[model samples]
Target chain A: MNSNGTTLRRIVLAGFVLLVTTGVRADGDASPIYGVRMPEGYRNWQLIAPAQEAAPLNELRAVLGNDIAMKAYRAGTLPFPDGSVLAKLAWKHVQSPEFEPASIPGAATTVQFMVKDSKKYAATGGWGFARFIDGKPADEAQHQTCLACHQARVKDHDLVFTRYAP
Target chain B: MNSNGTTLRRIVLAGFVLLVTTGVRADGDASPIYGVRMPEGYRNWQLIAPAQEAAPLNELRAVLGNDIAMKAYRAGTLPFPDGSVLAKLAWKHVQSPEFEPASIPGAATTVQFMVKDSKKYAATGGWGFARFIDGKPADEAQHQTCLACHQARVKDHDLVFTRYAP
Candidate 1:
């Protein structure tokens, strides 16, 4: 090949590699689980459910979803379609002094997310899970527990606990 | 007073001082503005409205309120009674690729709050304002702008912008 043609071909190949790497990273990290980033604008997504937990983890929880997740939730589609994303925000539960006996939120504890991509997260039932505390990613050990708990309890509901509040 | 009686009185006075300081800090900082904390369980509070802003500060915002605020909103009370607390959570806006043309949330931008206490905040039109970004308080100059904008644009609505969605 001519010198200029060779140089052009090499540049194109390098560009292709960079593009692929960027795409992979954007989808998620290398781990089977904990690959999902906190999905964009998840708080504005439709509310799937709200929950309160007692005992060791006294938390007030809210589950929200992106468009694909909301559509699947409303339609009752199982094995949720690709591009579906769910975010669960949790806070420590406190008592409302102004409204005696009523519970209120304390400090925020965690923000967890699940992204459904059948091909990408096929091992973990086609879903990638992640948890963040104050916007920082949780460790791998913590991430492992997410799949185990969901698989054991809510495997039937596509390994999800919250139902569509609507 | 006897020695034991004097000691008891001193202890009581110290306790009272401690309690008062704690209460003041809880309601807000020393500044007239930026005193409100993210009210406990605000995410679980009733959602009053959801909004989107364009350009410069493109954001998706959700407004949530405590029981007193929710009741007042439902009852259509104009002035919003004392004990009402409203939280506005905003995030960077992004597009949902799965559902093209629909916007989704990116990273969170701020969590702002308005607290009504007629006796306490009578100086600022019965409301105290605060803004936090990533859990840290915004500066005094930024906080001052909150009341100015609200007083100018929404003075009639008691300095609130979002109407109850229901």
Candidate 2:
């Protein structure tokens, strides 16, 4: 074989090794909607809102969105445009003794994402929901409930609960 | 005066002094919208969005809203409900050499608020806007332009721009 061909074969072998070691795949390729890979730079996205839930789910949540989502929000577009993505980061809510009555974040609980692709997630209201606990994909049972809850509660709003704070 | 009445007067006087020294005032009591006091525990509010502007106006912005605003957002309500307050904190955006391609906050530029009160700010589309630089209210002329800009560009969005990223 030619020297160039040998070099090409080596590059291909190295690429395969890297992929196997990292265990990363394109979003949605690994586990349908439940295991969508976390989007790059999601932490820097636009903030949609913050939330605090009580009782069984005592957590503080922050919702953020990508540029596509922000554009739809600014335009007041409904059903969100394709390519829109949202991330939710939650932490255990705790009281701050120094600043009485003020709540502060304790430990991080989960990081989740809701990706939109009309064609890919058409069966699930054009949105794919995912939750990662400690950076690991949540169980299948937990993922199944995501679609059901959104469909039942916020079907009219494109299966989304957040609105543009604008 | 009786002893009890004298003690009561002293307490009232002390309370007034505390308020003045802290530079805190009830919203709208000071200088129209320019001197509206910063709300307590605002940093804990839900983040509505993050922004980066370039050139003549280089800054990083974080938009946060109180519970009332978050509720309205989740429900997809328009005109945000009464008592929905949003704060925008901005800082000079600077590049961190240690973390290339990442931006870090430098000096804080301003903290601003958009307070909603249909009856109180009826002339300004039910929202009052205020900006403080270095903890001091911006000039009245600069404050006046805030409403005008929002009114002209995002009037349909209740004169606001940030959206909930659910």
Candidate 3:
């Protein structure tokens, strides 16, 4: 793009290769207990915020929200409504060959989702959770830990870890 | 969100407030020659990439693309199509008191755009550019420089600088 091409939170896409490196769906869908399927068009969703993980994970991630979720976020609605959906896309952080300080999303590790359906998921505080690796749903036991993690942590903010990033 | 609460490109919004610090807009709209105006519902655009400025600018900026722009990006379409539009949202970078390593978007700087209209902006490579501060367009002299700047740099990438950050 030019010197300014050096620009976007920096533009590093190398041509048409899109999404994660190991991104072929295995035809399996939906987490076992919660039955939450991967959201449609989740990749096109707007960002709620960017996040980084430390130590073993050492990942770069972003949380994205569906339209209803975004509307709630923009309005600062504390208790999200029935249709709220959040997707967390995570990739292993890799050192940039070109820039020393920058780390790019490399080898996507997971795609997780949090869906809100007050009556549908009352056991998990009005939310349903799912995690996928290589587009395949992880084990039910893996999903079982999602609510436990959210409850132990941000039970106050409706189990959403991401705040809207301006 | 618990310790994970420390997550998103890190969560810095103090509360429910969203968007730029100086977000209020006046009656005047659209740049003079291009007649390009602030896009409706642009805050919801998807992120293309994130960029940082050095020295005097010291800013954190992200480029956003509307549906058309996103399609072009996802498809790796060089010389973005006639309907493509890119929005660059800039903010001054400020230190985070809680985390020494993290910096957050501080004061609002400027919002700039490159709008594509093949027939309308034929002179500027089918793209019309606009810059706004506090929702007001800069002077015509300032507008005149947009083409010259882009031409000197990323004229090769259809004058677009961002790549879709997966």
TM-score for each candidate, following the candidate numbering: 0.47, 0.49, 0.66
Candidate 1 backbone collisions, by pair? A40-B105, A41-B105, A41-B106, A105-B40, A105-B41, B28-B35
Residue-pair clashes, model 3: 12
Off by over 4 Å in 3: A1-27, A50-60, A91-107, A138-145, B1-27, B31-35, B47-61, B91-108, B138-149
The pairs that clash in candidate 2 are A47-B48, A47-B49, A48-B164, A48-B165, A50-B46, A164-B163, A164-B164, A165-B163, A165-B164
Error of 1 at A85 (Å): 16
Those runs of model 1 whose alpha carbons end farther than 4 Å from true positions after fitting are A1-166, B1-34
lDDT of 2 by residue, B1-166 (tens): 6999999999989988977654345443333453467776565566665554445666556678888997787788997888898988776656533324334456778888888888878888998788878766777888878887777767777888766533
Q: Candidate 3, residue A157: CA error in Å?
A: 1.5
Error of 2 at B64 (Å): 7.1
**Predicted chain A of model 3: TM-score relative to the true chain A?**
0.82
Best by TM-score: 3
Model 1 lDDT, residue A109, Cα: 89
Q: Which 10 consecutive positions of candidate 1 chain B have the poorest summed lDDT? A: B22-31
Q: DockQ, per-model, please? A: 0.02, 0.03, 0.09
lDDT of 3 by residue, A96-124 (tens): 44344445566779999888889989878
Q: Which ten residues in a row have the lowest lDDT in candidate 3 chain B?
A: B15-24
Arranged by DockQ, best first: 3, 2, 1
